[model samples]
Target: MTTTHDEDAHLASLGYTSDFKRDMSFWGNFSLGFTYLSPVVGVYSLFAFAVATGGPASIWAVVIAALGQLLVALVFGEVVSQYPVSGGIYPWTRRLWGRRWAWMAGWIYMIALLVTIASVSYGAGPFVAMLIGIEPSTAVTVACAVGLIVLVTFLNLGGTNLLAKLAFFGFAAELVGALAVGGWLLLTQRHHGLSAIFDTAGTEGNGSYLPAFLTAALLGVYLYYGFEACGDVAEEVKDPRRQIPRSMRMTIYIGGFASFFITLALLLAVPDFGKVVSGEDADPVTTILQNAFGPVGFRVVLAIVLISFFSCALSLQAAASRLIYSYARDRMMPGWHALSRFSPRRAVPPNALLLAAVVPAVIVLGSIVSENALTKIVSFAALGIYLGFMMVVLAALRARIKGWRPSGPFTLGTWGLPVTLVALTYQVLAAANMSWPRTPDAPWYDNWIVLLSAGIVITIGLVYMLVARPHERHDAPHGDAVASTLDPDSGRATEPARVG
Candidate 1:
């Protein structure tokens, strides 16, 4: 139960380089947990699908979405805790399967982050215009997106400690905002009762209950997107194998329940779907609050929404920068050796941070140039995430079915087998459904975006395979099992070895 446990010897046996500092504690991991299950991004996702689905049933859709992601998270928690390496899913698969599969996973994950950075920056547009008192237009939106990238980059260069601190603040603000909105609705809608939520009667106009349910459920996956933030900081976390599993599971459950309750509350409180959906600017949460509690309520909700975006901006910067640093160290990215350099003063990846900022900033600018262009970009972003998830889930399932047991601080038990399978099933269905073109008249439709993005990632991975394969170190020992235990006294680093 202690945070600092012996993992050094175990990791050393597995050939984990000790050069990278392992300084973060369990609290740091918990903060990462909160960051991974972001509320603001959750809100943004809900709105996107809500608009598409054109019904109040978006609330239930979120619940179903969260459930699908939970399946993925379950497998992620089991596998990651077993490896607890900075390689994240890629290394985990490599350990389970081989290098080619690892490369594929890594390529998909890297592209996923790239698209995510673009999407987030794009999302920052509306909030930026709102913050600066400008008319809401595509041009302003893109500018805001660019600004977000820059701000996040600056924040990330400050280091792991700074990332943890920012995550805490962001988590707090998001929780408060979400709860405030949910609470206001719950308090006022006492008479409508909880049954209104579990009932299928309110799902008006969205043909076929299952598809309607699936539409809203897809948005809940957004809440689970960033939990891998913990995996990104694997070197820093205390007893990463143990703490990571704990954090991942905790984040999914808390985030899932919170989103479900909040969505239900909103659905129950909604008085007029027409007014709320009439304009792109319409926010159901804001509308409900304003109607019930007047202008003060409206302002409160707006302020919270803005704060959520700010937190997301900060966390996204940290995750993306670390990803850049990881890729550079692996020599998959150009100027790898130089980009992997850490700040002497702050012990952070300054160059990597800067690069992360630049890409996202460009995305923001693009969003500003074209109204909701970032939104379109993010649909591709979701595609990237699902693509990566598909690989990881398959890998995990392969391991399970083949009786390939990898030891770690955590295990998903019998449940993991079925969950992993289900996760894969859900991923394919969700991705296919979500990627369909809104208009059949549009050439190429939505399928091309997913195809092109996947093609680009695979091509880059193939190039890496040909050019950047690291020579195997014959002396490096590979352990079949990973052992990790926290240092109880110091709570700073894990004990060298206990399990492997």
Candidate 2:
């Protein structure tokens, strides 16, 4: 007995192409380099995490996080090389673990996207306020979020064509900005000591190097947050089986290396941490440049800052909307079919992009009711996303232990164990070092946030098991044979293989 994908047939009825065409050129994928780095990571919010922790120390945290995630990226590259589906981790997790685990991973992953929509909305707010020259009123914030959502949705409505164009521009802007800031700091070296960034105990608010270091590393992780967007765009990538892995691997290299250099430069450029920390405008990125170069330099930096913010927001919209389209294609969510429809004319997921836009718009408005709501949501979403990442990494490790070897286009070779270990270590540190503020201004309570995210995941998982497990069991294939589908590329229903 064969079960057909109902969603696919319905999508076909709308004249949508179910398959992601392999039309992305090498440069096309490369142009999206910034998109991989921009989302919460290489751009503005990166400064948020840095300031939240303790200036340059946060740089160390981001570096550690990057190292750990590089391990995760290795495994991701390996899987994507073989599967190359737009669903990314969801499909990879499903193919590795099978139906039950896949469903849960898919669900959790969707929630992660939803959480990101609002978080990005929050991140966009400060930039919006700065650009427009006004206080961040709730209405203005909401309008900015909504406006961006509209802009991105329109861009995505044209599918990879528009995304490709935007990706190139955004990627170029980010590259220029990162290099300009980093290069200036490196060349000037007025502060003159790279070691000062790491060694400085930081005067204000209880200066301990170890705790500060850990917190700073967490900031670094923010720069690495959305590199997985490479995988999300796997569907539209040319030679996805090979290209996806290459893109994933390159994203880590480009994004991580760029972030490291930026951090190093910013570290050297930081003049007086005490003055900057206590200053009226607390954003460390702005302060670092303003102090080093003065007002005129500061204005130039601010303009770059605005462009960086826009780039990040654009990237977030791209990734989140694609995830929504992927999930909707699976029929697990409402309006799933319609949202999955790729326009035959435009060749993009128009409805899904609009749907995704609405969510962030709602969040931006909600944030108006209270301050830092976007931050809380982003943190909240990050917790969920990181949990999914952890689970996928663990599963990948398990597959490796079981001698799962897939002949994908990309790999980390015999060093898989070390890589996985390094990644896990980074996650542990990032999770453990989060600071719970005594003051109410912090968007999240560090202690409760992680716990709450875990609780929600477990509760949802258990409920799914209790309620949905039976249906899945009843639908299982007979005679101890697990159901399988013929590979779309190969057209053969081979037994499942593990990935080492």
What TM-score do all the candidates reach, one by one? 0.84, 0.82
Task: Write model 2 residue lDDT over 58-79, tens digit each, in one string.
Answer: 5666556676777777777776
Mind giving the per-residue lDDT tens digits that candidate 1 earns over 57-113?
Answer: 556666666777777877888777766766466566666655566666666776667
Model 1: how large is the Cα RMSD against the reference? 5.9
**lDDT (Cα) of model 1:** 0.64
The per-prediction CA RMSD against the true structure, in angstroms, equals 5.9, 6.2
**Candidate 2 at residue 191, lDDT?**
76
Q: How does each model score on lDDT? A: 0.64, 0.62
- Which numbered prediction scores highest in lDDT against the true structure? 1
